[model samples]
Target: MHPIALAILLTPLGLLLRLYAILPQGKPTKRGVRLVSEPCKLGMFLGSGGHTTEALTLLSSLDFARYSPRTYIVSCGDTLSAKKAVALESLKASEILAYSVITIPRARRVHQSLLTTPLTSMQSLATCVYHITLSPLITGVHFADVLLLNGPGTCVIVCIAVYINRFLGLHSPKLVYVESFARVRRLSLSGKILRFFVDRFVVQWPELAAADSKAEYRGWLV
Candidate 1:
């Protein structure tokens, strides 16, 4: 094998190792936190319908002024979610130009064939990567300081895109995953998969939290 080829192959492994080294280890803890003097760049994925409702409910409790310059990523064709986001910002009275809604291809559509899902999923990741990295340059919204995600298939793609950001040495966002309020006894598929990746894994039910060592019970955050 050529030396150049070997180096190329080894480079990705090195990057992966670097990313893994920075990931939070073991169970998560509740800690005191101070509010940032400067407004944080917030990123959130609205999965549409119920997911959107739960996520917005959680955001309603936050001081929008403190988490200014929000980026709401919605699935393609999800105008409702985008509208809801705008409505929420209006209610919060955030700065007029404080938020942007970006649409990315969905990982899988309803009734999408299993065989074709991977192709669409890849497309979703590609779009996500483009938006996460290049959109900032065009729109002036740098990669989010904090990314909040809740259940549904598309959120997983966003998580992977964030991982890719870290692998490429970009300043990755702090990933926070909130399990759905409806998931009481067990972790949802998205929650189970994201548990290992997210910086914070929150479950609304105590039993769900107890079942997963990494999950934190936050008492129904929707």
Candidate 2:
């Protein structure tokens, strides 16, 4: 096989191996401090288009008190998400909540040149790894108690980073993945890949839930 083909075939296997290496082994300990008792920090990934809207809508339903010092991750050049995040911060000004928005290169930009896709992917991966591993220092909070994701390829890198942190016994954040509302019939590419690793996988459509036993239908988010 050509080198490119070999690399393509091995990529998924390599990712799985990395994930396994970082995951906790054996049964959980019965004794120790509970994560629930501590104040929660939130890390959210905001995708462009409909993804941003859906994510914000879901966030609005949650209690802000439980999740503070929130950090919003957006793709580089995604001004829309950054603007929406700013609006969200304004709403929380009355509550004195802390919020920050960080931008990382996108895994692949829309209508990107096919010849440059590989280069762009590597750049995006590097950016994701940097932000995910150094989030505590950059955002002034330990790992997020809950890492929320909706759609977009960018979430894949963030999830991997979170798991890597967990494997190193540095931080263990529950990854909550929500399928996009537009995906009524099936899971998106990102959703399909994340179902295995995310702590909570939720679908917006009943049909999707029925199709994938690993996912739960929690009604429309948009």
Candidate 3:
């Protein structure tokens, strides 16, 4: 992983985690303390996909309703109404009192645009860790390319998710990647190199359903 990516990811998390330790205790503190633990600030990286619905459905199995995440990087493969996209996101954020999400009009590659794009202060993690401050989901799905399943944008997305987790005084997010075997392997050589630097890899549904039977899907994650 690039140092810029790590710096971007860690700087905020370290500061927030420190302050959270000293802040006045409240109802939020009555939650877990692990990185993205239940009742903690759980983070998610939204990649473009048709199975996004399934992904979200599977994520519902977790205790997000307990910890209450700060944001969901909503990325889509095609041009869809921002209103619809937002409505879809509202499913996850509707219950939270404080939340913010931004949709980018055009961003074919998440790595080049999203990571490089500047996030407003309101989008950053301030209220998630410190209840007195509350904020909205900072989301960006500017590109509708859906070009590569796990492209640089995915890398940037993961990097940003980790960064937000670290910045908002929360723990690193546990990623769950759900996609077809072909899509998973479509990643470019450089992209594969970057993916290697990520924390961990997980494949869901069809991608790994038959992984044990076939060698192709065995290392599909890396």
Q: Quick one: ranking by lDDT, best first?
A: 1, 2, 3
The top-ranked prediction according to TM-score is: 1
Once fitted onto the true fold, the runs of candidate 3 whose alpha carbons sit more than 4 angstroms away are: 1-38, 49-51, 75-99, 104-194, 205-222
Q: In lDDT terms, how accurate is model 2?
A: 0.79
Model 3: per-residue lDDT, tens digit, 1-222?
999999999989977777555332322223334554334444443344533444344445545445443344444433342334355556655565533333322233444444544442223222222321222233322111111123324334434434444455443344323343345434434234433333333343344435422112334332
Ranking 1 against 2 by lDDT, winner:
1
lDDT of each: 0.87, 0.79, 0.39
TM-score of each: 0.88, 0.80, 0.40
Number of the top lDDT candidate: 1
Model 1 worst lDDT window (10 residues): 27-36
CA RMSD of each candidate after superposition = 2.7, 5.7, 12.1
Q: Residue 182's C-alpha lDDT in candidate 3?
A: 43
TM-score order of candidates, best first? 1, 2, 3
lDDT of 1 by residue, 21-89 (tens): 766678563344756787788999999999999999999998888887889999999999999998998
